[model samples]
Target: MAEHNLGDSHQVFDGEGKTFTINDKHVAIFNINGDLFAFEDACKHMGGSLGKGKLEGNLVACPNHGWQYDVTNGKCVTENECESGCRVDTFPVKTENNEIILSLPE
Candidate 1:
C-alpha cells in the first residue's frame, strides 16, 4: 500500500467531496460530518465523476445519471442497474497532522 497526502483536511467542507489524481488514478475524498472517506472518483454506472456529484449526508449522487453511493463504503445506495457490480473502489483514509492521507494499492 502507498500513502498519498491530499492537502489539509480543512480544505474539504462537511458534506462535500474533492478529487485528486494520484498515481494515475482519480480518487475522490469526502468530508462527511467531520469524518473523511475516500473512493474512486468514477461512478460504477457510467464513469461519472463522483467528486463532481452532489453529496447528501453520506450519500453522493452521480451527476451523470443519479446513481447514489455511500461515501463511507462505496456501496451503491440506489438501484443497482450496473451489470458490473455497483460498488466503487474505496480507499483507506486518515487525518494526520491536519493532512488528509489516502492509502492506495501499490
Candidate 2:
C-alpha cells in the first residue's frame, strides 16, 4: 500500500493522461478539464488497462474489447456481457493547495 500525490487538478486535459503514482490495482486517475476522477483501469470485459485507452469526451474506451466507460460515472456503454451489477470502484478525490489528493483505503 502506498500514497502518492498528483499535482494541481487543472493541469490535465480530456485525454489518456496520467497522474503521478496514481496507477495501481489496474486503476488509474484522469482529469477532465479541471475535474478529477478515478476508475478501475482494467476493462471489465477483457481486463484492458484503460489508462492507456482513448478518452473520447468524458468516456474512456477500452482498447481491448472496445468497451467504453463514462469516466465521470463509470457507466459501461459497450453493452458487454458484464453482469448488471458489475462496475468499477470509484475513488474519492479532493483538492487542496491547488493539488489533487486521492485518498485510497488500505
Candidate 3:
C-alpha cells in the first residue's frame, strides 16, 4: 500500500466528490462532514464516473444510471436486492496537515 497526497481537504467540499490518480489508478475521494472517503472512480454498473455523481449524505448517485453507492464503504445501495456482487473498490483515507491522503494498493 502507498499513500498519495490528494491536495488539501478543503478542495473537496462537504457532500462532494473529486477524482484523483495515484500510481496510474483513478480514485474518487469524497468529503462528508469534513471526513474523507476514497473509492474507485468508475461505477460498477455501466462504467459511469462516480466522481461526477451527486452526493447525498454518505450516498453518491451514479450520473449515468442513478445507482447509489455508499461513499464510506463503496456498497451498492441501489441494487442491494439483486445480490449481483457489484461493488466499487474502497480505499483507506486520512488527513494530515489538512491534506487529504489516500491509500492505494500496490
C-alpha displacement of 34 in model 2, angstroms?
0.9
- Show the lowest summed lDDT stretch of 10 residues, model 1: 77-86
Q: Candidate 3 overall Cα lDDT vs. reference? A: 0.87
**Which tens-of-lDDT digit does each residue in 22-45 have in candidate 3?**
777888888888888899998877
**For model 2, how does the per-residue alpha-carbon lDDT over 1-106 read when each residue is reduced to its tens digit?**
3444677666666565463444445456777776778866778887777777788788887778777788887878776466676667777776788786776668
State, as a TM-score between 0 and 1, how close model 2 is to the true structure.
Answer: 0.76
lDDT of 1 by residue, 1-106 (tens): 9988887999988888889999799998999888999999998777999999999878999999999988988988785465545689999999999999999999
User: Rank by TM-score, descending?
Assistant: 1, 3, 2
Point out where model 1 deviates above 4 Å: 83-85
**Error of model 2, residue 53, in angstroms:** 1.0
RMSD of 1: 1.5
User: Weakest 10 consecutive residues, lDDT, candidate 2?
Assistant: 17-26
lDDT of every predicted structure (CA atoms): 0.89, 0.71, 0.87
Candidate closer to the true structure by lDDT (higher is better), 1 or 3 = 1
For every candidate in turn, the CA RMSD to the true structure comes to 1.5, 2.9, 1.6
TM-score of each: 0.93, 0.76, 0.92
